[model samples]
Target: MKSSAITCNNGSFFNVFDEGMSLVCDEDLQALAIAVIQTEMKAVAKLADRIDRQFVQACHLLLDCKGRVVVTGMGKSGHIAGKIAATLASTGTPAFFVHPGEASHGDLGMITRQDVVLALSNSGETEEILTILPIIKRLGVPLIAMTGNAESALAKLASVHIDVAVEQEACPLGLAPTSSTTAALVMGDALAVSLLQSKGFTRDDFALSHPGGSLGKRLLLQVSDIMHRDAEVPMVDDSVLVSKALLEMTGKKMGMTAVVDEGRRVMGIFTDGDLRRMLEKNLDVHATRVATVMTRPCTVIASDILAAEAMQIMEAKKINALLVVDENRHLLGALNMHDLLRAGIV
Candidate 1:
């Protein structure tokens, strides 16, 4: 095996394998990885300069779109376009990816005059994308082009062209779509986020689009949505024996019971923790009233509050359960740590 020393940008020397080299050391591999990252970083950083008037026009076109933003690209650009479309849609912009090839097929119907077209082609000369340009123009929809070459046909024909041209590819061979694709993706994010802010998109709005995941559960799930309600809520009269309150807690499996008055207004709460303390004092459950040992002014939440907020309150208070009540102190429901966990909010 033979290797030669090469000077890195940091003025440090590292080994590079010779012609017959069949294996490389960790240091050489790390150096190559670092170079790739540095190249991509520079490419992304250059995009900051491209966020000029044309970028704003592209965003305005997308914002004013009455229908969905139709994104199209070819090959690797298509994959990035799909991701960009998803991000835009999830961020409150109605958008979907249409492959350039498919758009030339019957899928071109997906693009309407009300929609805005966003086309991605690194060389600005993807044959598939260029094939659909005439039809897109005939539809009279705004076309936003992302390409590397400003003089390319796609850029010249576009309503607005945003340059995603990179100085070089991260690939040593310089033929692969490495840094260029990243620049396009970042530029897409810039457009999507700008549109999101312009539309005043909120977390609740995002939750509507993502209702099936844990994120939806955190943002959309409320205290009332998962609380034990009606007959499921464990409750006992303040006049009841601690032993009877224990039975209510056990039957409901909530580990706690709200002690209410004759009017069904909550006075306090008794939990398994209280039972442990009662036993330490040798207090007889059957002889003692629940109100005598219950915690006064226990933590309570309203039904309209988010379940995530409830979790925060519970964690901060170091308590495992909360009583849901009306503004008039009327008991409505109950919940515990187990309930949050069951709802995937914990």
Candidate 2:
């Protein structure tokens, strides 16, 4: 046993505990926090080492699942189950949590034979979970059990047993679920991300699932969605003077104008930068045809391509404006850096 320090300030005391049965003073609080973190880390480390065929088998089961991954638990385990379900759902797997106690009261209707059941119970002897085990078996749904005690009832009834037994709880009393719950959460994430990879899930898939988020905007937003269209786009015919092209650019405030043919096909692009370079040469903007000053073979993007892809093209080419074109290279619209900026995509 070690001595516990009681720090008295203004006759008030703060009593804190340390790892060796010693007391933590204000000065020792950091060390106590480090111990708590290390204790939980060890649980995760042990889980990492024990990941064997059972973990791999769980991944395979989830990968091949025809429907949702139905996770259920009781008490503290139930909280972990709900979090695991949320993580899996957001990461590419279709999953949700079911309350085991509620299952006995008719919530079992939420599950089906096409789904896989992931039951979490540290002791593997949770009564609510055990009571519904027969019905889960009856429904012919595949059972995956996560428990500390492999020999316990839930494990015995499982089609695949995932033993998440931690050496000890981070809780000093060893009663509250701490290290065990952390280990379980990590294991669920491992399963979710691994299964995501096995399914060849991509950022595009994730973006679709998270459509209301910024990632969705980046991956799903198209050039056509943000481009200035119709008469809003600045354009001029090749026969127009460079000075007239500049008028279109100034009026539209796009810093550039597309030089087109009679059919509105993109012939070239004249930009403010071209004006600066031509000004140095003293070329008469009023006398030169827009085609003579425009940059030929300007970088263009398909209206249907992802806005993110268009941004990449812009950055790679070091150009700010892009002509949105059809398959025939006819100019449909115009997009500039300002457009992407206003759309909050820059």
All candidates' lDDT scores?
Answer: 0.93, 0.89
Give the top-scoring candidate (lDDT).
1
lDDT of residue 295 for candidate 1: 93
Clashing pairs in 1: none
**lDDT string, candidate 1, 32-59, tens digits:** 8999999999999999999999999898
Instruction: Write one digit per residue (lDDT tens) for candidate 2, span 163-185.
Output: 89998888778998998999899
Off by over 4 Å in 2: 1-27, 172-175, 282-284
Clashing pairs in 2: 4-23
